[model samples]
Target: MIKIVEVESNKDLKSFIDFPHELYKSDPNYVPALYMSEKHLLTKHPFHHHSEMSLFLAYKNGKIAGRIAAILNVNYNTFHKDSVGFFGFFESTNDFNVAEKLFEVAEKWLKAKKAVKIIGPVNPSTNESCGYLVEGKNEPPVVMMPYNQPYYHDLFLKMGFHKNTDLLAYLIDVGSFQDKSVKMLDLLSQRLSKRGIIVRKVNLKYFKKEIAECMTVYNEAWDKNLGFVPMTDEEFEQMANDAKMILDPDFCLVAEYEGKAIGFTLCIPDINQIQIKMKKGRLFPFGIFKLLLGRKKIKKLRVLALGVKEEYRRVGIEAVLYGTLLKNAREKGIVEAEASWILEENQMMNRALENLNGHMYKRYRIVEKAIL
Candidate 1:
């Protein structure tokens, strides 16, 4: 019989983090996360400030079979006014019996915590890389993204989960696509200035203050968005620290009007360029060399986050942000960029991207099921 075990000690938690290493041992498309990074993500990560989660492992006849985490986002529920729980950090062998036990444990714990509906495969939460690959199985996931076997989708569906919303990823080939976006950005920037708005590179000397401005806009602008959860000060700080290593100052821009921060965009070097060389997300001997050597070789970018504070909405701030990022990319000789995981219902952002010629290239889905 398969048995479900709660992760209680460091050793068990290590097993929970390392289980996927064995599960995907021979899968070429799979990339292993850094052992230490994942451990901290599970146990001591700053995300714990606003959310509570428990990790579990499933063993079948003494062999690891599956793993998952039950997440209770108190802040998310408070913001959305609903008691919705989440399941994330999920992975498993092909045995449905083991999978069922793992799922049941998360459901029971969440139910006891008073969660009414369960949604995800969110790794932790939507603020992080969230979703299951429902399409585009041939290409591996980009940096800081999730990848899984095609069969996992079947398992979730059989367990009664339905798609809540689909997330989109668009790809532009720098080598091929004519740079209409890049060419027009200067004109767009000038047009925006005439409208009383200006876009400028963020000043690193005031990093803390600028990030604070962003966090405030985030909380206000995204308050009513679907599956939106406000980031705590700790969470925002955690994210900032992670981005410091790869953030290009020019590529990170903010739009202002009369001196207050209103809109912003962050474009990160597709670390997948280096991540592919990373082998196992580590910084040891050869890893650092590969990263440094591959850094300049990175020609792709991910427009990681973009927001316009409420008062600045629908005033061409987004166009300015988009225009500015493209302009910086062109100057740096980088050709392609991805503005991703936009919620299907977020028509405003969608239109802004399409207006710049980005194509819908990849799709991921967030699925949910009520535990019976």
Candidate 2:
């Protein structure tokens, strides 16, 4: 018999967080998330201040068979004006019965909360890692991206979920990519300079102040995106703190006009190469050394985010940021990078990436079901 149990105690929560590590143990491409980070996110992260989430685990014959989190993102509904709840942090074995039972319980919980529709695999929200690997099943995921077994897609389909949208991941061969943007970077910089807008690396020295400035640009730049909800101050700060551990100022840039931050782009080393070697994703005893020593050896990056204020659009800031980031990555001996989770409908940015010879290599989907 399959049983679904709400994760109410510390032990159950541990099981919920650790289930994926066990489920993907035999998979070569699996990269385990850090245990401590997962704990904080589920237990005490700032997201909990404004949203509600309940975790559930599926047990079969006294062993964990699957796990999921039913979330009601009040902020998301308030901003988007939709009655949609979310199911996230999902993991399961190959058994269809187990997957079905897990989703059934999660949907029941959301239905009781009066949610009319359910959408996700959003590790709680779109501002965080979400989606399922639909196309890129052969390779390991990049930093801050999601990955899962091929069977998970089939499982979602069988459970009545349908694709809401596909997020695109583009691979750029930086070493071989030759674009006019790079060639004209100097001219672009000069034009921006004449307008008193300058692009430069993020000031890690004033990290807190820099983050605060960038937050303004970030919230404004992405406010109009589908499924976007402006992150509260606490949420953005928590993310910045987590990112600082892996941040390289060289790969993060800011665009300033008259000393006011107007835009920013952030890329981080694809540290999954190091994390994949971590057994169980523990950071103590030996994992810390691997992370610290392995960073410089990482040869790939992910263009995690890039945003410019609406007024600054069409001013070549985007091209300048991408050009400078590529030049720096090449100088650092980085051969390849992935700019991912780009919305399929974002034609301008998509075209810009293609212009730089970026190949759309992987696709992920956010699935949804009408529960009402």
Candidate 3:
């Protein structure tokens, strides 16, 4: 018989976090999440301060068969003025019965909370890693992106879920990328300079101040995105601290006009290349060395975030930032970079990446179902 159990104790929570590691063990492209980071996210992240989430695991014949988190994002509902709960941190075996039971329990919990609709695979929220890999299963995910077995898509469909939207991941070949924007990098910079706008690498000396400014741009820049909820200051700070550890200042750039920050882009090395080698995603005994020693050798990157103030759009700042980032990556011997989770309908950003010869190699879906 299949049983669904709420993750209430420390032991059960550990199982919930570790389930994916075991489920994807035989999959060559699987990259395990860092255990410590995952623990913090589940137990004490700032997200818990404003939202509610309950984790559940499916047990079949005394073994973990699946796991899911039912979330009621108060902030999301408050911001969007809608009644939608979320199901996230989902994983399962190839058993349709197990998947259905897991979601049944999660949906019941959200329904009791008075949620009218359920949407996700959001890993708790849109501001974090989300979406299920529905396409491009041939390769591993880049840093901070989600990946799942091909069967997860089937599970969602069979369980009455429908695609709400698609998020796109673009793979850019740095060595061969040729675009007018790249060729005009210098000319663009000179022109922007004449307008008192300058694009420059982030100043690590003033990291805190720099991040604070970037946070402002981020909140404003992404306000219009689908399902976007402005991150609280605490949430933004917590995220910034985590990124700071792996940040290469050269890959972080800010565009300023007359000393006021107007736009920025942040990229980080694809540490998944190193993390994939970690056993159980543990950072102790050996994983730390792999991370620290392997960072410089990583030649892949992910453009985690790039945004500009609404008023700054179409000012050539976006092109300048992309061109500069590519130039930096090429100089560092970076072979590939992925600018991802771009909303599929964002033609302006999509077109910009295409102009740079970026190929949309991966597509992720956010699926939803009615609960009320």
For candidate 3, lDDT tens digit of each residue in 251-308? 9999998888999999999999999999999999999999999988898999999999
- Model 1 vs truth, CA RMSD: 1.9
**Per-residue alpha-carbon lDDT of candidate 2 for residues 59-90, written as tens digits (9 for 90 to 100):** 99989999999999999999888888999998
RMSD in order of candidates: 1.9, 1.0, 1.0
Give per-residue lDDT, candidate 3, residue 300: 93
Q: Model 1: clashing residue pairs? A: none
Error of 1 at 202 (Å): 1.4
lDDT for model 1 comes to 0.80
- Residue 184 lDDT in model 2? 94
List TM-score per model, in order.
0.94, 0.98, 0.98
Per-residue accuracy of model 1 over 74-120 as CA lDDT, tens digit each: 88888777888999999998877777888889999999989878999
> Which 10 consecutive positions of candidate 3 have the poorest summed lDDT?
134-143
